[model samples]
Target: MDVHGTVAPGFEAVRDVFAGIVAHARGGAAFSVVRRGETVVELWGGLADPDAGTPWERNTLCVLFSGTKGVVAAVVAALDVLDPEAPVRAYWPEFTAEATVGQVLSHTAGLPFVDAEHDLLDTAVCAAMLARQSPLWTPGSRVAYHPLTYGYLVAELLRRTTGRGAGALVREVLARPHDLDLHLGTPPELDARVARLVRAPDYRISTFLDDPERRRIVERMYAGLLDSDELVNSARYRRAELAAASATGTALSMATLYDLLAAGHVAQQAALARASRTWSEGVDALNDRPLRFGLGFELADPIGTYGPAEVAFGHSGAGGGRHGAWPQAQLGFSFVTNELRAEDTDTRAATLLATLYDAL
Candidate 1:
């Protein structure tokens, strides 16, 4: 299915994108792109299911996992947007963790993972635990991906000050202002637009379940974290805010929203400018995980094989659910798919990146 659309008179950029999608589809993946605040490519041609019955669709929504943290950070950035001096702790008093707002924004707060032994569904209690949690390293000593913790920390802080849940605040203050449809929790009205998530071939491992050591690691990673995915799909989880990972929306909205944020339109750019310094200057190749991180954002690593050298800021989901906003070119790019594949790893996202950079 071709979700391709052009906003400008030129067609070459769009054509290249289509070609890239064709490449991905033949190889069992999907691709999309946006340029200058307009979607130029929304191409999808792959199987969303094993039997190949449901074709990959443009509206597919999948678990972004850590990638969704960027969005949550952006929402927290709203506070800095409105009031840069407002102590982050002022919003979240529990944030007395030996770090400052700048450190958190820069991903040096030293709170990388939650207790990992607790349930995650409980946001308030878990967030309070983080406030008093010990620092993994001296605050701001080094950069590491705060994969599961950043979102909860930011949400708790935002909630303390704003008196509104992070999900609602994001919708009221940010999304509504920009007219973007990106949402943290899936609203009932948007249910029809949600594409059913298609599980990838290697998503579930009977081995991980049966393996003791692996289970121990998994348990620690989200000790208190709730089984949110299962909850979000339920009516209760939809109403309940799971800002860390339950965000559900299209790639189009995600790109467009971030483009506006990066371009410094709705709020002041000065606030985010300070944190814009590249956090992970180069790949932490030794760190085991291959992801590249920036201040509350991410750049596709050359080694991971995703995003562009000029990647302004974007987050990606496993199995090709990706979105990015290009500030340099005033471009907003988004891509989504129900088709999940095991081979479309960090390297393949890079192949998509090359196609996009060439289009530019």
Candidate 2:
């Protein structure tokens, strides 16, 4: 594979690791790193459209899936509008009166899954549906990953507080000022730059099942959610405002956003520190693993996806996208690919992360 990009001096090892990974990837991928606000490495390789034989150009955009969570969280934190301890109902009267913003960000809010019939694009209808439902468990007692509803809740809050769409707020606050190319919804003009995602041949939920009990729990937890790969990759899905997922951008844009946050103003840094603190840690009810989460970011765990640096904070997408920053090392990293694989025990991203850290 011919990797096309550059690395700052003394970072050749990082580029080598990126090249090796891209060489083996079934589809195209991009990797980037920023150290102390400087772009130290940026590289991409492979075929963006494997079927069409299109090259993965520097401008190719890939869906970030749940990695969108980190960006959403950063926008909210930077605005510093909501008091973490305040009840979400205080801001959005449609939400359950007892659930707090902190609980919502930490995934302890009982509103995880929504009705299968709920129209995700209709914000008013979706908000009404969530408002009518009761909590599955007492709010903030246990942790459950809110796969899709998280973005809705947070975006609704933003709408009520800022009188602007979540995407608009994110662009004005983070992307515009930083010159990042990320987007909550891909505009029509940039649609051609989107890469085609290729699902792994053997990928399935059963690949992560340990026993029947865990499988049963996972199935129940994931009920009413859209698990079909076809729906996720559709044009309708890309154009919709699904904040928890559906973010599209290049690896450089993702890395640049994280780098800015990692080296942001005092208030922004303090907000992120509070958000990244250990709000929940233990075996998660939905995923059935020892997962750890801060406000909205997943913390690095011993058996975690983003390596073992405890201070590292970011969110991993369902397939192969990973974005985070290591405050201790002053490093911001992002890995994005069009190859969709089961995320449960995948170590490809982690291997690259470890190699990057070692090179430093």
Candidate 3:
């Protein structure tokens, strides 16, 4: 497999590792890294669309899935609206829940899944549903990954405070000024650049679970949500604002965004720090793994999802896409793919991360 891209001096090993992974992988992927705000490696290979015979170009965009949460968290942190201790009702009067903004950011707010059948694009309807629903657990009592509802809550809070939607605010405050290509709500004209997601051949939630009861519970928990891969790749879903999941962009853009946050703009840096601190740590009920979470970002785990640094923080999307920044190393990295895989036990991203850290 031939990879097309460049690596800065002394970073050839990173490129080699990426090339090896793409060479053997079933689908295309892009990996990028930035050090001290300079791009050190930008590489991509394989098929963006195997069926269409499209090569994975540097500009190819892929869905970020939950990785979108990290960008949202950074935006919120930069705004400084999260008071860690203040009740969320303080900002959105309609929100009757007693959870704090920090709790919502930290995934401790119990509104993980909105039970109502309201349209997600209808912010008012979704916000109303969120307001009416009771949390799965007492606010801030435990950590359960809010797979889809997180972005809605964040967007609602932003809408009430900033007089703009989360997607618009993110573009205005971060993407536009930094020239990052990331988007919470992708526009139609850019649709051609988005890559089609190819589901892993052997994905099954039950396969990862050993206990019958646990498998049953996990299956039921996810049964009601919309089919995520299909929804995300659809034109309507891509065009709408699903802030937690629908973000589409290149790996370079995601890495560059992290680079900007790492550059130490007082507010952005402080926000990044707040988001990277371990706000919660325990076995995640959803994935059934010992997980750690900062404000909105997932902290580096023993699983190596965010690489080897205990201080690294970022988000991983549904498939194999991983992006984060290691503040200790002054490095930001992104790995994105069109191949959607089961999150449990998939070590491709982890392997590349280990190689990158070793090379560094």
Candidate 4:
């Protein structure tokens, strides 16, 4: 496969791994790594649009899915306005749950799924549903992933605190100054640069139907839009400010965001330390794995998602998109793709990550 970017000398192995994955991938992906404020690797390959034969350009923006969480979390950490221990109701009076701001960011607040049916695109409706619903468990009592609700709640709190949307904060606080191509609510003019998402040939939704609770959560969060290529590739989805999932950007831009964060260019060191502390740890029913969380970021786990860096912090998207920073290694990187795959079998990002660590 012909990859379209460059890597520093020692990072050739990382490029080889990416090329190997792209050779077999039907869709397109981009992987970039930054070491100590310098870009060590930037590579992209495959079809941005297989049907149209659009090449994945150096700036092709792909949906980051839940990787959006990490970006928004970075923005939240930078703002540093609300107290993490303060109840969310302090900011938004209508917020019923006693869950603290920290609990929501850490995924410990039990407002995982809203009971009533509503358009996820409609932020008002989703926020109202979340505010009305009671926590499945006492706030901060358990660690359950709030796949979509996390963003809605975060957006509301951010709005209440900053008098602006999360996307606005992202643009002002991170994108503009850092020259990043990332966006929580992508504008129409940049539509041409956005890569179209496609499901991999072997893609399959793991509906946890055997367990009623898990089944309900999975269906509510991902039943339609998450699995629908037509919907996700639409302009509406890209334009919506779905911070938990709908971020669109190139791998380099995501990596650059991490680079800045890692260098403390955006948030204070104290704030970053607080956000990186282990706030929650338990079996994540949503992914059916033992997981750890720090604020809005996913901490390094035994599986080595961040390439064996135990103190690494970042978030993974639904289908093989990984973006994070390894403080110990002074590295920030991202592997983003438009192809949706089952995480259990996907090794695209893992292989690239391992190769990157080995090279370092």
Best model per lDDT: 4
Q: Can you write out model 4's per-residue Cα lDDT over 1-360, one digit (the tens) per residue?
A: 588889999888988888898999888899999887889999999999988999999878899989999999999899898789999999999989889999999998888777787888877689988998898888888887787889999999999998999889889988998899889889999999998889877775552235666776777766376766898999999889987989898888888888888889879999999998899987764646667899999999877777767679999998889999988888789999988888778988888888888888
Give the per-residue lDDT of model 3 (tens digit) for 1-360: 679899888778777788887777677999999888888889999888877888888899988978889888778778886677778888888888889988888888888766756666565677778887788788888887777678888888888888888789779877888888888788999888888887777655423357676555554444333345566568887877777888888999888877667676524666667777889888765556777898888888876678777678889887788998888888788999987777775777887778777878
TM-scores of all predicted structures: 0.77, 0.93, 0.93, 0.97
Candidate 3, superposed: residue stretches over 4 Å from native: 120-123, 205-229
Locate the minimum summed-lDDT window of 10 residues in model 3: 219-228
lDDT of prediction 1: 0.57
TM-score of 1: 0.77
Local error of candidate 4 at 301, Å?
1.3
1-360 per-residue lDDT for model 1 (tens digits): 343433344446555555555444522234445555556655545544424345545554444544466676676565663243355565566566667665665566777666544556667777778887887787767665554566677776666667778778878867788776667776788665554554444543112144575455444554433332344345554444666566766556666666677667644676556444465543221133454555566665654434555556666654555566667766656555554444333244555555666667
lDDT (Cα) of model 3: 0.79
Best by TM-score: 4
Q: Give the Cα lDDT of each candidate.
A: 0.57, 0.79, 0.79, 0.86
